[model samples]
Target: MAGVAMQLFISHRVASTDVAMAFMIQSMAFVCFNKVSTAQYFVWYLSWVPLVLPQLVKHSGRQENKGLITAAIAWPFGLAHWLAWAYLLEFQGYPVHLFVWGAGIVFFAINVWCITCLLVRVSSS
Candidate 1:
């Protein structure tokens, strides 16, 4: 978990309330405190990283490379992570389950739908 987390994101600054940092902390706890296995946690973290960053960066000001916003579009996975994790904690042992499944399905589908919409807009431009 720690090894994979080290690569999750790079924030030399104080990192603040970002999802990566949260997962990183949770990863540490799962591995260090609860003795959770690393492989599965790594996969879980990766699946959720995309959904987490934006809210973290909401206070992060602007990206150093504004053009990279498209790439950073993955950050919203953090928001999904927050919501899904909450639902999981309330319902699925906090590890992620069917309750959060809707969140993932919606997030991924909306992701595709939004991307297609954006592409259409760009092309029409």
Candidate 2:
């Protein structure tokens, strides 16, 4: 799988923590673009979050980087929204295909924004 290849590439090629963070961002991008992505797929990249959290926190302490912090905070809420819609459609048999699609789009946008903020912070650090 692409994720496995990416992880292996990062492990073998990345010598710096910042570069590893960048690869993690790329992994998140891969999940966003994957047509058949499932909730469990998120674990692939989220597993790196704690490793980079100290860096993120260091960058977020600046007053002007509040937007970055906000995006970080908002991503999970976006995921929850997407999951709620997915659950309704899958389990409740709700006629909400449009809602699910819309939620998916919004979640994707939030994810992209969060990734962008992280990339900026990671690169600038």
TM-score of each: 0.31, 0.79
**Candidate 1: residue 27 lDDT (0-100):** 42
After superposing candidate 2 on the true structure, give the runs of residues whose Cα lies further than 4 Å from its correct spot. 1-17, 59-64
What lDDT is reached at residue 59 by model 2? 46
- lDDT against the true structure, each candidate: 0.44, 0.77
**Model 1 clash pairs?**
50-77, 51-76, 51-77, 51-78, 52-77, 52-78
In candidate 1, which residue ranges exceed 4 Å CA deviation? 1-82, 90-96
Clash totals for all candidate models: 6, 0
lDDT of 2: 0.77
lDDT of 2 by residue, 3-122 (tens): 667556544544355765766777787887688868998998889988877767774547437878788788889999999999999999999999999999999999878767765676
